[model samples]
Target: MSAFGKDGVTGLYETHLPVARLERAIDFYENRLGLERAYTNDERRVAFFWVGGKQSGMLGLWETGTAPLGMRLHFAFHASEEWLLDGCSRLRDAGISPLGFHGEAVEEPVVIGWVPAMMLYFKDPDGHSLEALHVLPQPPDRAFGIRSLTAWRQYAS
Candidate 1:
């Protein structure tokens, strides 16, 4: 009964964030995170990076100078369990702290029971919360709540 049919939406294609410095943001996303740069506009003070692939998803960074109060936004990128698990060390090597769901420094990804997904959180150069997430191969258990992977395994057993 929808005009767009039953297909609905597939996934996020693009996301934009405001940054205080374009070059610094570019270094964090492109050099540190390993995202491929798709395009950049020096005049418009914006840049775009390919997330997974050229056709998969894109992230746009706009240099808006430093805001007085600063508005922070959060977004997640689809990742494999292996990447999420190993990202803690990789992030630390890059001088970034891998964080848990509660915003605490962590050594491993945390499980969001409602979504039943493992996620690793960190901040970009501009303080925008970024996450690498991978859905678990299990049924959702809302009562389980958010916990570390170790706790989740123990609870499941």
Candidate 2:
């Protein structure tokens, strides 16, 4: 059904985002999220952080004064199911509101049946959408659609 072969690519290694302030972004990512600082270019007003592990994956933040209207981007970070399940309280404690797919505040993660993954959403200081996700062990079920994790278990059972 697909034209591409299996050897096309492995996985995502890096992503870049525009930020209003480099220091603030660095603080949120480094001090808050605990990502290791890989490098920072003061001249270019850019910073890089190592995600997961050193030299494995990276996130880059570029200082752009202000994020343009409707320029919000989204990215997800791989997380454990346990971490994602407790995301709501953890995020709330960190002053971040956990959100559902529609951007409404929620107490738990949702299961996207297409991907069959449990995911929680939030926004960064720059208004860029962020997610913490963990793939389920079951096979994908497009017909199942998206729903709360509780509903997903009911349907699956």
Judging by TM-score against the true structure, name the best candidate: 1
lDDT of 1 by residue, 1-157 (tens): 7766657767899999989899999999998998999999999999999999988999999998655867789999999988887989988988889999879999988998888999999999888999999999888999999999988888777
Model 2 lDDT per residue over 1-157, tens place: 5565686756689999988888999998887777899999999999999989865789999988553553679999989999998999988888889999989888889999998999999988989999999999988999988889998999998
TM-score: model 1 vs. ground truth? 0.93
Assess every candidate by TM-score.
0.93, 0.90
Q: Which segments of candidate 2 are over 4 A away from where they belong?
A: 1-4, 65-70
Query: How many residue pairs collide in each prediction?
Result: 0, 0
Assess candidate 2 and give its lDDT. 0.89
Model-by-model lDDT, in order?
0.91, 0.89
Model 1 residue runs over 4 Å out of place are 2-6, 65-69
